[model samples]
Target: MNTTLFDRVSAVQADLLVTFVPSEGAFPESTAWVDGNADGQLSQLRESGVFKGGLAQTLLLPSITQDFAQPVLLVGIGKDAELSDMQARKVIAAVAAQIKSLPYASVALASRALVLKKRTQSEVTALIAQWLNEGFYNFLGFKQDDAEKATKVTDLLIEGDDEAALAIGTATANGSAFARQLGNLPGNVCTPNYLASKAQHFGEEYGIDVELLDETKMDELGMHCLLSVGRGSDQPSYLIVMHYRGGEEGEAPHVLLGKGITFDTGGISLKPGPKMDEMKYDMCGAASVFGTMKAICELKPKLNFTAVVAAAENMPSARATKPGDIVKTMSGKTVEVLNTDAEGRLVLCDALTYIERFKPKSVVDVATLTGACVVALGSVNSGMYANDDAVAESLKAASQISADKIWQMPLNEEYQQQLDSNFADIGNIGGPEAGSVTAACFLSRFTASYPWAHLDIAGVAWSGGAAKGATGRPVALLTRYLLDKAS
Candidate 1:
């Protein structure tokens, strides 16, 4: 969508004019002209309790004036003091949902109507654009009927002069949309090779350096633990790397590792048949990495960034690794494959070991690694595990800035005992209790070489049931973190 800025509401021209109304206050001065032009219609609605400006409340009215010949959408944002960043995001989401199916070609937002506490105009502008784009997103790639698709707003006009903020917001949203598209594809269409191809294409488009290590090269590097997970699938596993060097020469890059199990069927220890199709979203962690990289490429942060994806597929076949199998990782650590279902950590362990070669400034690995995370935090927050306090704090700050909820989970040495095995250095699965904590502890063993953090995104990666699609989460959080680092 095209975004333009106007200085005054009177000068704005669009198919729809959107303004936020507080629960108990006069309309914003910037929108005063709108009320005057409408001949007290807005006040009449408020006086009649038809539009009291409660949070997420909305009212639509016809336009009879020549100053703006479009319908006005009054969206309630509640009190200005209580308008937290997440609440503002929800308000914008509501607005997007209200107009998603409407045939409006253009929409104008009264910027001054959004007066979020502790947030600057630039931040508000960015938030508005980012959430609107995200809220408007729909994956219709496989849908054959055109009529079934909803009409989308083509142009967004904001009453402001923050083009840079608009750019950042738009880039972030585009990145998220890209991730959602990749994550929503069926498992058959989005294989490990497909992810590698996507990475190569991303590198070419963004002028970054891309490298792909096939199963042969990985085997040569002793990535047996990673390779063993993909032994059953015909699709080859890959260690895909992309480097973005926007900083000075020889700078230690911030590394991002992603677990890319394109389609996980639990291998020899197969999962239940119900909702098996949702396994297609197993690669969402890798998709978020791609999304973050895409945004970084667009924003061009003055810091080197490296993305590593361990791409594989897990299926039960004659060649699949069974329970009790042990494989040595690239780090020379042996892992007992007690449960094939816990495959995300298997690939990630090798990737974490491999990332130590970069001597990275910090490493953050993203993975849809556990259902225990979903059980613990539900769909509200991604589970975070970090070895370093500073890294954890930084992510916490980023989570606030991006309004992407995350709760830091414990990674105490106590959890390490659960991963112990008599036959190997460690075991892939740590029984049933605190499954998410044990998974993080497994990855932490390899991350000892660098300041590292792990994000278990199993809960927030995608929604099930009627809204069964990728949410493209944590891209906003990751991008904001990188942006802050660059600043």
Candidate 2:
């Protein structure tokens, strides 16, 4: 898709032109291009009690202008109140969905219609582009029939002067689309090897240094905690690292570790039969990291960063790690596997420990870690746990600005008592109480070397039922945090 900005809304020619109408106010300045009765259509509709410009409401009318051969879409922005990023996303996404099936070749969006609340034009622009791109995304890679073919929006014209925001928005959306594609694919096609290959390809294309540590190397390095999770699956596990050095030499990089359990079957502690297929989304944490990597690579943020994915597939087989099994992590800490379903932390713990070699400035790990997180935060917000208050505050600030919500969870030392094991240094499962906090407490043991945060994205990773698919979340939050750090 081609996204650009223009200084004047009237100067651009498009098959569709979009503007906004507030419930209690007149049309925005961007609608001045419309001439005669067509320009007054919105008022007529309102006067006739047909249009109220409520949030997410829209009305389409034929254009009377000879300069353009298309219609005008008047979207609602709710009262005259300041527009929030989440509101803008809803409006833009609704608009995108409305036009997605239309036969328009190009569309022009009036930037003036997007009223800024506590955000700048650039932030709003980026958000608008992100939602549009995400809404246009289709995961038909495996579909052989053309029955569900996707239609691409050829040109997107944002009526504004901020091209940088346009580019940033497009890139961020592309990153999200990339992650969604990865998350939507079947486990057979998106295995650990496939993820590793993608990392290598991304590194080669964007000049990032990529490294792939195979099972043998992991064995030599004593990453048993991570390696044990993949032993049951035919596909081997790997440690995939992507290094981007956009900052000065010797700068401590921000490390991002992702639990890449490609297809989680709960290992020896098999999950129930129902909804087990959704386990394919277990790697969404890794997919979000890949998405963030794609965004930062394109935007070329001036910051040193490293993304490490503990890529694996958890299956129940004769070779699977059984409950009560003891495994040693790279940190030399022993873990008792009480429930193999808690395998995400096993893989993540090793990777977190391994990243200590870099002496990272800060470390953040993302994973579909626990159902307790889903119970606590639902699908609306990701559960965030940080060792440092400042780190958690920074993430909260990013969440506020990016519209990707995150709720900070407790990480008190009291939670550590539940992880005590008679056979090992710690137990993977801490009974059933405070499950999410205990999971974080488990991983926190390995991240004591630096300021660390964990994002439990189990509920927010993907949707279920009729509209089931990956949400490609937390990427926006992560990208926003990185952008803030870069600035």
For each of the candidates, give the backbone clash count: 0, 0
Q: Candidate 1, which ten residues in sequence have the lowest lDDT sum?
A: 143-152
Candidate 2 off by > 4 Å = 35-39, 65-68, 145-148
Task: Estimate, for each residue in 1-487, the C-alpha lDDT of model 1 and write its tens digit.
Answer: 8877788887777899888777777888765677788787777777788889888898877665675568888898776655777688779988988888677889998866786777788888888889888888888757687446755688988778898888888889988998999999999999999999998898779899999999989999999999999999999999999999999999999998888999999999999999999999999999999999999999898999999999999999999999999999999999999999999999999999999889998899999999999999999899999988988999999887777899999988888899989999999989999999999999999988889999999999999999899999879989988888788
Backbone clashes in model 2: 0
| lDDT of residue 72 for candidate 1 | 87
lDDT of 2 by residue, 192-272 (tens): 999999998997799899999999999999999999999999999999999999998899999888889999989889999
TM match of model 2 to true structure? 0.96
> What are the lDDT figures for the candidates, one per model?
0.89, 0.88
TM-score of each predicted structure versus truth: 0.96, 0.96
